[model samples]
Target chain A: MTSRDVLFAAVGLITAAAAVLAVTNRRVLHAGLWLVVSLGGLAGCYLVLGAELVALVQLLVYVGAVVVLVLFALMLTRSGGGEVDTSPAHRWLAAGVGAGMTVLLGGALVAAYGWDTREVAGPGNEHIGEEIFGTWVWPFELLSLLLLAALVTAVAVATTGHSRDRAA
Target chain B: MDLPLAVEIILKAVVVLAAFLTLPLAIGQTEHKVMAHMQGRLGPMEAGPHGIAQLVADGIKFVQKEDVTPASADRWVFKLAPAVALIPYLVALAAIPWSAAWVAADVPASLLLVLAVTSVGVFGTLMAGWGSGNKYSLVGGMRAGAQLVSYELPMVLAAASVAMAAGSLSLTGIAQAWSWWWLIWQLPGALVFLVAAVAELQRVPFDSPLADSEVVFGPYTEYTGLRFAFFLLAEYAGIVVMSLLFTVLFLGGWSGPWSDTLGPLWTLLKAALVAILILWLRIAWPRVREDQLQRLAWLVLLPLALVQLALTGVGVVVWG
Candidate 1:
């Protein structure tokens, strides 16, 4: 394998390990941190694949925002001292299912694509803008609307009746 | 005779070394002098004119001081945290286009790369807070995380407006397109971006994580000596970077009144002006309450950014 391929494989291994750690880590906060590592590794994989935009979005959204919010929620819940039960029963069964699914998906991907090398097309930024605003404008707008709704919901949940609590 | 790769590497090394050594000192001196003036004092009149060497003295003191690690801290992550906090700010300088051809690496998505690297700086704060095993540090780190996340969206949205207006992700390309400058057309977006930038750097009014009275130095409460100095340097570097970026992306970059004549000097002048403003804000403002900070971001800035984005989109379609 080429050096790039080796790098990709290494990144994939790191990502998988981090994912496992995230799921199995005892501390909720530590697990959340591991989730950052896993997601960050996945972003690195995307970077290796030459998807800079996707990689950056992954870093920005997952590392910068989502995991942070998760940590905030963890802290706000006031469960800092509790021992988290990370281990789940039927671990062998779950691993078996995961391995099977991975194999099946890998088989489907290999069969469908057949090692056909395609040129990566023109500059990504222009293409992304065109794709986003031209053919996918409706969905793009819909996503924004949904995000607005989610923001409203978050604010409502965070602020409602808390103003009174502040004075108390 | 053709120069070897090593020679080029040496030249680049010299440039970076010069910058790393000199820029921080200059910026630090400027901050102290500005802070002194704002506080109605003479401000660092010794060590050199305007106390120019005050930062150097501070640096020496920091180096000579005792470096202590709290007993309760996680040794590995605690040690790693300050370096983590500082390195991203240095890496970010690589992507900031100083002039038309003066970028360290002219990557296709330089802006995004800078944002990604700087985002990792937050992890340093988070790890420092958590690993320190101090409640105050934990709270500080948590506050930093929340503030960074909330402000980041509005910051990204503000950047997107510029990207849409300029039709490029390259910082230099964006700067080159500023016939009228995006700041003039996207004033509201620029304002939102400035505020978010301050919050990202955890500066005044938004510096809840470091609120002395509230959190007692927050994440860095457990850090001492040079390790703590690194965090302070990183914060200042962040301010410098954010101001430079604001100059490059929106404020006509190096294109000033005398841009045709004074190329990089013009850019430096503009960036320095903005940096001065940031320093002034830092000294003049008081720390905002955490909840008020969040409310200002989500309730006010986010909607303003969204509107700015919408306006930019419409303007682009109509004018481009």
Candidate 2:
């Protein structure tokens, strides 16, 4: 394998391992930090694949903002110190569903693309921008609207009882 | 005569790391003397002639002092946090445009790279506080993270406006685009950027995270010896980085009447002026309350930044 391929493989393995660790970690704070490691590894994979802008965005949004948000919520709520138990029934159900989905998806991917040797298109900043604004404009706009609605709902929920006290 | 690219990069990285290691001495001493003069005190007068060797003496002391950790502190995280805090500044130093042809890396997205790497330092500060196992340190880390999040919005928005104006994301490109000093044209954006930059550095009036009066040096309280020294050095290095960024983004970087012949001198002069200005603010202002800091960032600076971005976008379309 080429050096680039080796690098990608290494990063992908790191991402998968971190993800698994994040799910199984006992302490909530440790789990959150493992998720950061997983996200950071995914960003490294993107960088190795020559998607610099996407890699940067992943680092900025996921590693910087999302991880901090998770940690902040954990700390602020005083829930960072607890150890969560995994019951046998829940573990068995999760394992069954996960294995089934992985098998189905892996089989479908091999059937569809195993015969092809064509190179995949690497998406750069300009290409991604054009695709989003041209072909996927409606979906992009709808997603933004959904996020806005979520934000407004959060604000409303937070202030529901505060106005009465303020008025008094 | 050509060196391999890997070798070239390693050499450059070593040079940048050496510079990062030594910069705090000169800069820290200058800050001490400047603040001392302002407050009518002699700072570090006994270390050497006019305290010239004060930082060197301080460095020796840091190395010789016994390393100590609290009984409750997490050993590994406590050890790793200072390196995390300091490495980003060292890495970002590689991409800085000291002058034309002087930067170690002139990547197309150097500006974004610098911002992204430097933002990770917040994680370091957070880890330091959390690993200390002190309630005060944890609260300090939380405040640091919140402050970083609040200020980063306006800082990025202000930078985006500059990128729009210059049509490039590289610091060297930004410097080359400004035939006239950019400060005059983008004064509003520059002002917003400077304010947000101070908040980003957690300087006075925006230093609730490290407020000695409230939290006892915040994250550094549980630290001792070389570890505390690293945190202090990181803060000084941050001041230097921000000063260089302000010079590059707003003051027309490296471009003076004689820059063609003088080269990096112009850039150094402008950056020094910015650094002194930041020190002036530290001496002049008192610390603001945490609530006021958050309110000013969200309620005031964010809106101003958005307006500046819109104006710059319009100017680029109409005037360019």
- Reference contact recovery of candidate 2: 0.28
Note the Cα lDDT for every prediction shown: 0.83, 0.84
Q: What is candidate 2's lDDT per residue for B202-299, written digit by digit as tens?
A: 88878999999899878778988898899989888988888888888888888887787676789888988888888899999999899999999898
**Per-model fnat list:** 0.61, 0.28
Model 2 stretches astray by more than 4 angstroms? A115-121, A164-168
lDDT of 2: 0.84
Candidate 1 TM-score, true structure as reference: 0.89
How much TM-score does chain B earn in each model? 0.95, 0.96
Docking class of 1: medium
- TM-scores of all predicted structures: 0.89, 0.94
